[model samples]
Target: MLVAAAVCPCPPLLVPDVAAGAAPELDTARAACTDALGVLAASLPDRLLVVGPAGQSGRGPHPEGTRGSFRGFGVDLDVRLGTGNAGPAATERELPPSLAVASWLLERTGWCQAPVEGLGVGEPLAAERCIAVGREIGGRPERVALLVMGDAGACRTLKAPGYLDERAAGFDADIARALGSADVAALKALDAELAYELKVSGRAPWQVLAGAAENADLAGTLLYEDAPYGVGYVVAAWS
Candidate 1:
């Protein structure tokens, strides 16, 4: 597939981490994530990749809730960094465009992020510098830009309904493919009022949900409800 940008959904990419729910900034970040997910879902690509800054919660260096890899987003992927082998949870840091591409700065900067060694979020890079770094990384296919500037330390709790809704958007097509349905009714089978099965029996990964996702059988099974957000995003595609 060709590289593309869904357009910038949020501005001032780098923001301080604040408390969740009550923190306005974090809320905005969630909203941005939600918006981005919507567009990506609407596009209905065969594969989806989500890259974000993981937090190391003193459990060996990777984020607690994130999976190092997953098969659901369509194919193979390894886009996680944090505690518990996920990498260290570092503070947010902003640097100038000039410093982001500097090997010296990247080596010296305190912006610690997984995928990158010895960098912390506290040390941010200039936009131009970051772009340069991206350039240095070398281009390939599908450059989906998703800023990991959200509540640095704030906790995000997704309600059952919200999670189901997100799953519908993120995996709607996948659901359709699995069910062999031509309509969007498969994902609509999820019910907000049902109990959440955050875990599946005999699963190695604790966070992996087994039966949580609703069945894709489109035979008049429509337990899921439309999102309360009621907001549709622009599905602009670019090369």
Candidate 2:
């Protein structure tokens, strides 16, 4: 059953090398992520699962020790999901970009509290399916913890990735409130089509989290929320 969870934004920019000189821009977010991880560590779960958004080619399960690279982001850096002998499947399938960012955060924190694994949720995955997958995970007998990664609306400003949209701020605001309070119903009720239109990458994965915590009765804390480079990034912890 779910024991704890940490939610964070999954931008490659979270990596100092990837962000270069602008790394300082995200120092607060990074610190918040670190604190969120601390909560998971405190839970002493038997298993840790990292969940993130992915494209068609990146969807599905990634085992512990699975490899991920930031080379695609031009950093030439690599990371592993966690410490362990990677199985044949792990060796063959590389982690998606969001998962790679999670891997980077795990490495930064030196996580060793539990066996780790990853699941890449398709950005366009239906909320029902996402919730179902999460239900299965929460139903597992082992004490489980999750590190969920994805970004909110990308259109907060005129220079944002999706450009300024009048609706972006409201969407992100609702998301922040839901994550901050661990309001599973609100997360599960998120409008998928609206999220797609807003280019919100966190929608599907957040729904998965909502599903997982359905029976966990976790309490949440919002650690950070901001729109740097016009991308909505939020950090939260549930215990």
Candidate 3:
């Protein structure tokens, strides 16, 4: 069992730009998550890039310089998941794992857009967060499959899990629901997040995961839940 990781950092699912007139509910994002997982079911990846966030700078430069950032865990998923081969872009229907996070993102709102690039970050949680993930995996010498997607700041500073269980106490419920659901569905369906991790036989601890759960909370924003992986207990703290 080799411990490997991948992340996919994404901007707010429903951007003010992408969903101007359309009024999508968390359920809509849920619908999108459902469709996205279906796509992932057919096509799995080698590694998982987990992205993070960096919050917003409000409107400044450009037409709308409302630069939101992330320092969570998923950004690493975006870059690592498809690092080996960037052969071609995924089709609207194809839904690559990185962009697949959009499925979960869609569950939240219809008022934001996916990030265009990775830049300008805030406090990142990748190093400390992933360590818990990695340790739970126990540095297995096998292909560790993960689904990472958060903001860019956290994405940029991809690090191992350190002593970073500082914010697990004040998490809300929405974050919990998202991670819990994602983790559960991934495992049960053996098709989505849990589904794929099972393919690689990866596992992490609940307490370990809880340490970095805030990465999801701080950065998850509108994530529905953590899809299941293998041998891993879902640990989430949220409002």
**Order of candidate numbers by TM-score, starting with the best:** 2, 1, 3
Candidate with best lDDT = 2
Global lDDT of model 2: 0.95
Q: For all candidates, what are the clash counts?
A: 39, 0, 81
lDDT of each: 0.24, 0.95, 0.28
Any runs in candidate 3 off by more than 4 Å, and if so which?
1-6, 13-18, 21-129, 138-144, 153-239
Candidate 3 lDDT for residue 42? 29
**lDDT minimum window of 10 residues, candidate 3:** 58-67
Instruction: Say which candidate scores most in TM-score.
Output: 2
Superposed model 2: Cα runs more than 4 Å off: none
lDDT of 2 by residue, 83-178 (tens): 988888899888999999999999999999999999999999999999999999999999999999989999999999999999999999999999
Error of 1 at 96 (Å): 20
TM-score, predicted candidate 3 vs. hidden true structure:
0.23
Task: State the weakest 10-residue window (summed lDDT) of model 1.
Answer: 200-209
lDDT of 3 by residue, 45-77 (tens): 232222232234311111111122221322322
* Candidate 3, position 61, lDDT: 14
Q: Which RMSD values do the candidates have, in order?
A: 18.7, 0.6, 18.2
Ranking by lDDT: 2, 3, 1
lDDT score for candidate 3 against the true structure = 0.28
